[model samples]
Target chain A: MYNILLFAKRELRVFVDTPVGYVVLAVFPATMAALFFLAGSFFAESEATLRNFFTWMPIAMALLVPALTMRMWSEEIREGTEELLLTWPIRLRELVLGKFLGALSLLFLTLLATAMIPMTVAYLGDVDGGVVLAGYCGTFLLGAVCASLGLLLSSLTRNQIVAWLSSAAILIALNLLGLAATARSIPPSLAHALETLDLGLHFYSMSRGVIDAADLLFFLGLTLFFLVCNGLVLERRLRR
Target chain B: MMSPDSSVLAVKVQGLKKSYGSIAALQGVDFEAPVGAVTAFLGPNGAGKTTAIRILTGSLLPDAGSVHLFGADALRSGQDLKKRVGYLPENNPLWPEMTVEETLAFAWSAQGRVGHKMSAVERVVVSVGLEPVFRRRIQECSKGFRQRVGLAQALIHDPELVILDEPTNGLDPLQVIQIRELVRELGRQKTVLLTTHVLPEVEALADRVVLLHEGKKVVEGTLAEVTSVKAGQQQFKVTVNGSEEDLKSMLATAGVTRLESGFPSSSAQASAVVLADGGQEIFEAAVKHDLVLLELAPRSGTLESLFYGLTQAEGLHV
Candidate 1:
């Protein structure tokens, strides 16, 4: 626990000390906000509510979260700092969890900055505060899952670009898995299996002011699975 | 068998082995490093010196061996054991993102040590001789200071045993001497496991030495114990200002069983004299003949020669 907190503090310090964090924090909110306004004005039929704003996030995160997390472990290995960290009296799980939580905190802070859009929606028309709260919960969980996936992929390679591209590819596939329902000939069982893994379909259920136990379990389970895998990979490298 | 008082063995390795697929990095290597002593682990490149240090310090696990640190099983609970061991890898991986003070504090706390406040960090910084640049970001620090920061982190926990791999690799001669002195000072109260190929370093600092070759322990003991002179294989160098032919004939008749010479024609002061056996008899005869000997001394074999001699003699390149 102390190890995790120590490392997490260091990770946060690193984020604040460099321009990379500021760039990610600014780019995600700016790009997502711009896309939301453009789609609302030119393409959508009605004013953009928190639903429309939340709908654009997973797509935005597919690119942004990978950029944020690609350097978590990969850069450490590339710079040989991983050896230093490994030699310290730190358990593998604690080290991984520390960095995971640190990255999650940064993402959450960036997500918090976008609360103005939902607050703006509340002023314009009748908006269910429960749905808005659920949307934030679902979005945060989705970001958590994405960040863990990104961190796990980042652990496998030292090349940050490779980490980014591979994580983005995985996120894209998982996000679009439910959309394969367009193939009319596809069987229901196979489609259902794909939908269960599809992050987009789960968020759709959350956006409708409904939070299913399965949806929450899916995100939590995926995050835990990837984090465990990340820890295992790090343990193997340290042993080697 | 070992004792707690007289034999403060900081490290004890037996049947240590590690392999990466088909390549065995360490093979049945065993050694003992005593407490409050500087033990140099000498080896050529790829000779598993770093691998052994990593295993002892809990960074790498051995495939088939047992390592005990101060009599505690190193493998069974490495994290618990690591608190007692400070390791400096070949590359000093100082965190560039943090200042020297911040980095050292983070490392000190990581070892589960409390009271490593500003005073503690400042003490290590001053001890390693880095007080001038404690506020600088590590990325901005010079290589020597970076190395010092690495050393400072290792020393912050004040571990019982400190293992340093190639600690003087990048330093200039002056910095190397300073680090050597610091290490010697530290070794007075703590066990130090230093690795290097430099012969004089081991001779100057190490109380005991282990020479490794091809991932095996070739020889390990006090400096004199490994390089002691024997009757048949004694070695000496004699410098004489005489005719090359006369020098060779004189050495041969003086009971110098084997002699090899490489003298330059321009300088009579230059002459090569190698005697394989009967060093004292050859010296006495050469002196009696009134040979204008420039210099004569035993060719003190160093850790470098010992490493090359043992490794090459064993037909192992590394």
Candidate 2:
């Protein structure tokens, strides 16, 4: 537990010191607001809620979370510091969990940066605070999922560009699976299973202010799955 | 097989084997470093020196072997055993963005030690002479100072065993001497295992030598033991003002097998390696032929010659 916090603290410091962290923080909220107000047709809808922001948040996170997590393991491998880190008296799980938490904390801050979006909606109309809170909750959970998947792909390679591209590609595919167009192309049975597996679909369920246990379980389970796979990849490297 | 007294051995490995695809990195290699000694792991590139060090440091897993450190099963002992061993891997990898102070503090905290953090960092900082750059970020430091930071992190927790792989690999001459001096100082209190291909490094810092060749340990002993010549044979580098035939005849009479001989130069000075005692007979023959013996020095075996001989005999392109 102590080692995990130590690694997490160091990782957070790295993120804060590097330009990538600021880039993600700036771009995520700006893009979220642009997509919500411009492409989302906020005036046309005349909605009293951040429904459009929630709608675009998953897709935006799919792109930006990879950028946040790409260098988590890839840079260590590239710099050859992985040897120094692993040889320390820390467990593999602690390292992975700590890095995951660090990236997630940054994602949380990115989410918090968009607080004005919710405030603007409330000032303009009677925005339901419960639904707004649920939407943020869902987005945070979805970002956690993306963070873990990005971290896993990062561990598979030493090149940050490769890690970013591969993770972005997979996360985008998972998001697309939740779309109606993708569902129409597949058979009903296959579409049902893919929809259940779709990460965006789980977030959508939570964004509706339901907070269903099934959706929460899906996000937590998938995150754990990716993290475990990351651990296995590191273990394989040790043996190899 | 276990040693008779395992407690005295800081590190012990038996039948350690590791292969990447079809290429074997380590093959049934066994060696030990006694407590409070500097053991030099000498091998050419691709000779599995780094691979063996990685295994000992718990950075890699062996296919089939046991690693015992300070009488404990290191392979399974986990953090408790790891805390006792400090490793500075090859190339001295470190976070360039971190200040020297943060690097030491991180390393100390990573060991799970509570309290005394400031004192621990102070001790290692003083020991490795890192005070000047203690607040400087690693990226701004020179290679020598970066190497000192690497050493400082390894020693932050006051580990019982310090394993340094190529500690002075890319340093300038002065830096090499300074690092060697620090390593020698560390040897006064801790068990030090250093790996290098440089012969003088072994002579300068190591108390014992372990030579690995082609994934196998070819020799292991004290410095003198590993470099000792066999009985009844002696090597001499003799430069004499004599003809080739005179040198050859003199060597034949002296009962010396010529390992190598050089051609006579402008001054008719030729040198030859003769397997005899001090070339006393060759000296007599030189006198008989009126050949001015410019030099006759007994050539002692060196780690370089032994390393090359062993590697070359195995058809390796050393």
* CAPRI accuracy category, model 2: high
Q: Candidate 2: which pairs clash? A: none
**Who wins the DockQ comparison?**
2
Give per-residue CA lDDT, model 2, range B1-318, as digits (tens).
Answer: 111232499988899999999999999999999887889999999999999999999889999888999989988886888999899999999998999999999999998889999999999999899989999999999999999999999999899999999999989999999999999888888889999998899998888899998799988877887776634445577777866667776666665556555434554667765546566887887787778888888887667666665566434210
> Best TM-score goes to which candidate?
2
DockQ, each predicted model: 0.63, 0.83
Pairs with steric clashes in candidate 1 = none
- Model 1 C-alpha lDDT versus the unseen true structure: 0.80
Candidate 2: misplaced stretches above 4 Å? Answer: A180-185, B1-7, B230-299, B314-318
Residue B31 in model 1: lDDT: 92
Put down candidate 1 lDDT per residue, B107-179, tens digits, no spaces: 8888888773778898898888998898999989988888889889999988888899998897999888988
TM-score of the B chain in model 1? 0.78
